[model samples]
Target chain A: AQSVTQLDSHVSVSEGTPVLLRCNYSSSYSPSLFWYVQHPNKGLQLLLKYTSAATLVKGINGFEAEFKKSETSFHLTKPSAHMSDAAEYFCVVPPNRDDKIIFGKGTRLHILP
Target chain B: EAGVAQSPRYKIIEKRQSVAFWCNPISGHATLYWYQQILGQGPKLLIQFQNNGVVDDSQLPKDRFSAERLKGVDSTLKIQPAKLEDSAVYLCASSLGLPGPETQYFGPGTRLLVL
Candidate 1:
């Protein structure tokens, strides 16, 4: 079985400041990790993924994340935040050969002016 | 290329009523998925289909919820005797079903409200 956890239920950041969203996972086998963002009343859009390729993965909207196997963490980060970045973010683990993708609860992001 | 498509962007119904949602995956994509997103939560997989066959549906509430993917193209999810907790946004997604890893493209989602 595979599971993911989003550490924060809500995160508020000032515009132009840095942002971070934390996630951790427990999987029996090597896993595929993904980050998705959802705007108000909109469906989720893929942000980035870590599939055992590179430890550091860059994504759309100038966002990026690092996969740390030792810590079992995939934390999203951005050097600067924008008002438009306010949205709900999810961390997902695609199913392995036998398991299906498992999603984290989610983190609501708020941008302060 | 067109993204996934879903119908009746929104629906409102009373508890115990039945409601159905439809989805059309991207052309040539053989994998389709249906997920439920409640307010303040991440989307949960209700079902997954590889072509016209079921791949996974362990979380689906089979007693009141049913889904089918006919002809390996379009799919529909039906909930009979719906409950208040079932109220949420239903999302449809598709992938190229390529060997290795690929991104899943999502539809706008259909929001359902049960009163």
Candidate 2:
């Protein structure tokens, strides 16, 4: 079955340090992927998406993701982490043959002051 | 543009009780989806609708859950005789149903706690 994999369950970064959240999709061919952020008791907010266009997708709040087809990865990255950036991030892919989309287990980002 | 809307942001109930969730998708969106999000896990697709018709509900627990989208607009999901494990956040999302499936806009979600 098709799936989205997010290896790290949690990541901690000191304020002003870089951040990385890895995501990999399992499929026979390339599919559009996306990143979304969720804060406590809040709805999800789209960060960025890769739809076979540019390999690098820049999103809101200074976050971005690069789609590497060869690696089957669409890892999210940010140069500097902020306190407000602490949240749960999810990687999503288009619906599979079952017409259901796949969501990675998510990676929780914690920022240290 | 207005985003998806869900009512009753929170609910608490005992096992075997019945509860329902309501969702109103963004105007002009042809597709609406319902998801179950367990703690520390990503959202799982429950059901999907396109223009008041069911597109997918393969993951839905039909024995205890039901959903419908009327007039291709507002939708409702009901769980009868809810189970303790049913406690989770329910999310509603909508898409324009464009050629590429389009981006999905999610609602604030309705959190449920089953005791």
Candidate 3:
């Protein structure tokens, strides 16, 4: 069995400041992790994914995530948060390779100017 | 390079009423998924189809929820007598194939409000 836990329900960051969203996972098999961003009434946009190849993964719009196996964590980060970066972010874990992608409750990022 | 598409972006109905949502996956994509996302929650898998065959439906409420993929390209999800708790966003996603590790493209989703 596999599951994901997003530590924070919401995060607030000032524009041009750094941003971090924490996620942890538990899986019996090799885990495939992903970070997705969803704007209001928009579809989920893939931010980044970790498939065992690289520990640090970069995605669109200056977003990135690091997959730490020892820590059992995949946390998303951005050097500078933009005003448009405000959105709901989800951490996903596909445990068994089927289409059963388990999602985190979601963290709503608030960008303060 | 068209992405996944879903129709009936919003729906409002009273309890015990039935509703259906449609989805069209990306071209040449063989895997399709339907997910239910309650407010403040993540998307939960409702059903998955691989080229017209069901891959998984364990989380689906079999009593009232039914889904099918016709011709392996388009799919539909139906809920008869939807309950108040069923009010949520129905998201449709599609990927390339099994053993995933592949990015699943998602649709805008259908927001259902059951009163």
* Candidate 2 residue-wise lDDT, A1-113, digit = tens: 55689989999999999999999888776787888899887888888888888999999999999989889898999999999999999988766543346777899999999
Q: Across residues A15-103, which tens digit of lDDT does each residue of candidate 1 receive? A: 99999999998889778888989998676788988888999999999999999989999999999999999999988887664335566
Q: After superposition, which runs of candidate 2 have C-alpha atoms over 4 Å from their true positions?
A: A95-100
TM-score of chain A of each: 0.94, 0.92, 0.96
What are the DockQ scores of the candidates, in order? 0.50, 0.53, 0.68
Instruction: Kindly report which residue stretches of model 1 are placed more than 4 angstroms away from their true locations once superposed.
Output: A28-30, A97-99, B99-102
lDDT by residue (tens digit), candidate 2, B3-108: 8899889999999999999999999988999999999899888998998999889999999999999899999999998999999999999988754433677899
Descending-lDDT candidate ranking? 3, 2, 1
Instruction: For each candidate, report what fraction of the true interface contacts it reproduces.
Output: 0.46, 0.46, 0.71
Which ten-residue region of model 1 chain A has the weakest summed lDDT?
A94-103
Interface RMSD of 1: 2.9
lDDT for residue B31 in candidate 1, whole number 0-100: 90
- Score chain B of each candidate by TM-score: 0.96, 0.96, 0.96
After superposition, candidate 3 runs with Cα above 4 Å error:
A28-30
* lDDT, candidates in the order shown: 0.89, 0.89, 0.91
Task: Pull out the clashing pairs in model 2.
Answer: none
Which CAPRI quality tier does the interface of model 3 achieve? medium
